[model samples]
Target: MGLYHNRPHVQDIRRMKARGEKISMLFVTTPDEAAAAAAAGIHMLSIEGRFFDATMREAAGDCFVQVGLPYGGWGSFNGRPLATAEDYLRAAFHYAGIGGDAYYCAASYDIQKTLADNHIPVVGHIGLIPSYISWTGWRAVGKAADEALALWRHTQKLEEIGVFAAELEVVPDRIAAFLAQNSSLVMLGMGAGPHADAQYLFTEDVCGYGLNHKPRHGKVYRNLGPELARLQEARIEAFRAFKADVDGGTYPAPEHVVPVKDEEYEAFLKAAQG
Candidate 1:
């Protein structure tokens, strides 16, 4: 593992919040994406545990990386599902050892607390957790007064559980602004507007290559989807041309084949005939 002492720690992120600095964060899966984010001087990166390792950490450079622990049944070890706090803790510790700066755990309070107690910086999720979308459906949260209050209470609960930050996703901008100003937890905003401590976006969304429906808050900075499609077409055409060359005996041209000495070929022919 490369030395990652220069990466931002939990206190550093909190200090950024205190200073009212707007942090840039991205959810990236590939090493190339991580390296690009690092090169661009992104403050934080959210990577899934499955995609995080020493290589990923190295690619992330000095950016604070939040390795996401897969929640509940989605998380596993040796074909067994992670169903308990210890299971989640093991996952978090594994990534932490790999140089992960923080962990994003949307698991139960017990799991979150376990990671935090072990000195693992934990980032919790609030306002439109996709995993629990069955209850709230796909929409902006904290619109109603009671719902907003519940969201505020949820943030407090996460803070009490020792979580250092929370993903404030798809909450009303006004509500999110109010909560960010009042809350101790650093808010990593997805759809939560300018008042957040950090603005988070998926790499695919920013690059405009995502296959899924784009969220209203996700801004496409570059439309690389068409370019990527063109590349795929080029790949197919190149393969087809190679196949056609082979079928038409145009591939094994004189220059493409190794030349043997005439005397050696004659000797081989004589031996074969004998």
Candidate 2:
């Protein structure tokens, strides 16, 4: 909201949701995709901090961007090694300063609160969180009564900590509905059900470029894989053609050869002789 005056932001998303707006969100990596998303009227974007450089932000136009903090593996898995909660606060503030609309962090409630304290709109993660996927065995959560209750309780804790939104991932429809209906938090559904305020998906999944077969949750709208394969084949053919041209001495045609003055050539010849 503050210096993000140049673009529509979290405040805008919140306002629209309060008025019962339905929105679509996507994970994007390119300015081209951002432009398309803006044109498509997508309300929210979950983008890596590196992906939302000046170009992508400009492409985003008025759309809100939730800058994703790292979620998994080696360094900063669940954001622990990245920094203390205070460190995330500073990082979040920096991103916000540069026009990030919100910050997505799967962290302890205390850590999430730290970001909110610094005026960074925090989007928390719940229900089959990826970083802790090993514990849940990489599957749906909130299906069991106790587990679902825990998720509900966690949602309450997140609300109490003043998170702006919560990403509900791979939870049962009934549980998602219950949480969305009960919680004041803006529920963004990713592999969750329709009750959520916004539907979210990764770019790779949406464009049909995801590894292996598409997940049951993903609706592969286009067969980018075949197109991509065709493109790759074309690229290989291009390189092969260029190789043939070079081998056949067909490259460096007269047009490609630089013109040199006779005097300059003579001078170079004389210098070499000397």
Candidate 3:
């Protein structure tokens, strides 16, 4: 609610959840998107550490920004994945130093706890973890009762580890609602339905410019793909025009070329000849 007044401290977010408020969250990759989210008074933002800098933090304005620490080799730093708990801890502190309100960690509970122990707020991932998609295979999780119970237990475990939040992705709405109502951890919903603490979506999905297949819950607010295609064509046409001008010798016209004083030109010509 204090979107424009001040950056929501982590405690503020927790209090929002405690009050049963629905929070707006977006996963953004650029400063422009972060700025837009902030200006629009979005409650929270999820940004990868790679894209998170002082500029982004400033652009994010009052939104509580969650810096995602890479889960595995998928997102690498210096061509290497953050392999150890220490790596995640180090990355969390680094981002925290730059004003990251929280960090999303998909590592083991121990690693997540390590971050929490250091007083770093952490958001854990559950219910169709992308890092382990090879096993789960990119589908809705917790449709069955046993699976739903498992997810509930997972949320409890994360809570026990002191994680402030858990990203509930692609889980049944009923299951998500139960978790949200029962747990202390804030539920950041992706494909999970309406009852979670926050509704989270990637900006690419919202803009209809996502490179990958859109998820079922993803709602495209604008179609930017066609606009981007048009821009690409314009870019090609401009390049072609430039090339044609260069080949036809029409680019370097009188005004385009730098001119020398008559005496300076004459002196240069004589010097060259000599």
lDDT of each structure?
0.91, 0.82, 0.91
User: What TM-score fits each model?
Assistant: 0.88, 0.88, 0.90
Kindly list the per-residue Cα lDDT of model 1 for residues 180-248, writing each as its tens digit.
999899999999988888999999999999999999999999999999999999999999999999999
List pairs with backbone clashes in candidate 3: none
Off by over 4 Å in 1: 2-4, 75-78, 243-274
What number of clashing residue pairs does each candidate have, in the order they appear? 0, 0, 0
Model 3, 1-274: lDDT tens digits are 2234478888899899999888999999999999999888899999998899999998998899999998788797546799888888878878877888899999898999998999999999889999989988979999999989999899999999999999999999999999999999999999999998999999999999899998999999999989988999999999999999999999988999888999999999999999
Question: Which residue runs of candidate 3 sit more than 4 Å off their true CA positions?
Answer: 1-5, 264-274
Displacement of residue 178 (Cα, Å) in model 3 is 1.0
* Greater-lDDT candidate between 1 and 2: 1
Predict model 1's lDDT versus the native: 0.91
Clashing pairs in 2: none
Clashing pairs in 1: none
State residue 118's C-alpha deviation in candidate 3, in Å: 0.7
